[model samples]
Target: MTAGTRGEMDEAPQQLPGWAIPPSEGFTAADLDRLPVPAHTQLIDGGLVFRSPQSAFHTCASYLIVEGLRRHLPGHLRVRREMSVILGLRQRPEPDVCVIRAEADRAPDQTAYEASDVLLVVEVVSPDSEERDRKRKPQLYAEAGIAHFWRIENQSGRPTVYVYELDPATTSYALTGIHHDRLKLSVPFEIDIDLTEIDAL
Candidate 1:
C-alpha cells in the first residue's frame, strides 16, 4: 500500500468471518455506482458489504439522526446516508451517515472526496460491526485526518452516542462527549439535533 502525505498504514490482510465472504477483487468506484440496490447494502473500501435487513429498531434510530441532520444543519453543509466516501488508495467506505461541506459538483460519478472535504462521519453499531466501528474504522478515519467521528451504540435496550473529535498530537480521535439524552451536535453544522428522537425511531 502506498502511504500518502498523511502517513497511512498498509492495510493488513483481513481474515473474513464465516458469514462474511471475501469481496470480488479489482472492484472499482464505477462498479459501485452501477450495483443494484439491495437490502442493507454498502461498499467498504471498494468491496460490497451486505448486512441482514435492519430491524425496525435499527431503521428508526438511523432515520432519526439522518432526518434530523438534514432538517437542522446549515445550508452550506450536506448530510447524506450510505454515500460512498472515497479513501485514497486503500478503500472507499459508505458510512451510515456523513456530513460534508457543500460542493457544486455533488454527483454520484465523482470518484473521490478528499478528507479535507468531510466534516463528520457517523456509524450505527450493530452486533456484527462492533469491532470494526469501535476499533478499526476510527483508526482509519483518524489517519485520513477526518475531523470528527461518532459511533452510535444501540445494541442494548437503550442507545448511546459516542462523540469523538480528532486529536492531532497523536493522530487519533479523542472522546469529546457521550450522551444518552438529547444530543446537540454542533460541528460543521449550525443547528442542533436531539438524538432522543432517535429512540423514538
Candidate 2:
C-alpha cells in the first residue's frame, strides 16, 4: 500500500485495494459523502476533485469577504461560508461564500443548497484555483441560473473583487464592476464593503 498526498489517496482508481471500489462508472454527491476522504472534496463531471489545503492568506481573505457581506446584507438574506451548492446531477461544488434567500419552507435537513436558492456565489482565487474560480465556476454558476457571482483576486498583495451579474437572455455573465479597497453594489440589494480592513489581517 502506498500513501498519497495529505488529503488524497495516491493510488489510481483501478489500482485501489480490494476493499476500495473505483468510481469508474462515475461519482455522485452521495458517493462522495460515503467515501473515506478528508473534507473539501467536490464532484465535477462525475469525477472527484480534492482541493488543496488553503493557505493562511486564503482563509483570512475568505473570512473577510463573509464578514463584509454579513455586515451589509439585509436581514432577510443570509450568507454562508464554504457551503455545498448542487449545480446539477453531476456537479456539486462548495464555493468560498454563498448568499442565499432565507425561506421558512426550506428543509432543515437538506444536505446541500439548491442552485435556485442561491442569490450569489463568491470565490476567493488561490494560486492553484485561478482557472477553476475564474473560468469554470462562473460558467457553471451562470448556467445554473444563479443571479450573481463575485471573484476576489489578490493582486500585488491587495484584494480586488470582480463582480458579475447574470444575463438571462444569454445565460452568461456581464462584468458589472471591478473594485479595490471598497465594493459597492446595487443589485439584489444596496450595500458597500470596505476592503481595507482585509489587508490589515
Candidate 3:
C-alpha cells in the first residue's frame, strides 16, 4: 500500500471574498475595506458596483475639471478625484471629482470622506454610469444634504455641464444651469471654466 493511502485530504472550505457571495441584505459601505486589493469599486445601497474601464474622454474631462478647480480653489476648500464619500452606512459612491472642505485634510492614509465634508460632487457620465449619474446618485447626494452636484456629458467631444443645487425645503436637487463652452458659477464661489478646453485635450 502507498504511504499516503490512509490519509484523507483536508476538506475545509476556503472562504470567499465579500463580493463572491453578497449577504442577503447586501454589502455595507465598510465591507469595501476588506477587498483583496484596491478595487475600482463603489457601494450603492449595499451593492458592490465594480467600475468599467475608463475611456480616453472620461480621463481627459476629469483631469481638466480637477485642474481648473485647483487653480481657482479658495483658501477654505480643496479638490479631490475618484475618492469615495461615505453618504450612509450602506451608501458610499465615488464622485469623479469633488470639492471638499480643507479641514478634511490630505492624510496619506485617509481612505474616505464623510459626505458632510463635500461641498460639491461632479460626475463625468460614463456610458455605463449614465443612469446612476442622472438619477440615483443625485438622489443619494441630495438626501445626504450635499448642496451641489454637476453631471458632465460628452456632446460631440464637447463637455456640457448640467448643474444642480439642493432645495432646502424639499431636500431634492433643482436644475440650476446647463452650461456649454464656458461654465461660470458664483454660489459655491466665484469660478469660470472654459468647457471648450477639452477640444485641445
Best by TM-score: 3
Give candidate 3 misplaced runs (Cα > 4 Å). 1-19
The alpha-carbon deviation from the true structure for residue 174 of candidate 3, after best TM-score superposition, in angstroms, is 0.5
- Listed per candidate, the RMSD to the true structure in angstroms reads 12.2, 5.4, 6.5
Which of the two candidates, 1 or 3, achieves a greater lDDT against the reference?
3
TM-score of each: 0.73, 0.85, 0.89
Q: State the lDDT at 73 in candidate 2.
A: 87
CA shift of 103, model 2, Å: 2.0
Which parts of model 1 have CA positions greater than 4 angstroms off? Answer: 1-48, 108-112
Candidate 1 per-residue lDDT over residues 25-82, each given as its tens digit: 6455455545554544555565666666566656677787788788887778887776
| Model 2 poorest 10 in a row by lDDT | 13-22
- Greater TM-score among 1 and 2 belongs to 2
* Clash pairs detected, candidate 2: none
Model 2 TM-score, 2 decimals: 0.85
What is the alpha-carbon lDDT for the whole of candidate 2?
0.82
Q: How many clashing pairs per prediction, in order? A: 1, 0, 0
lDDT of 1 at 84: 59
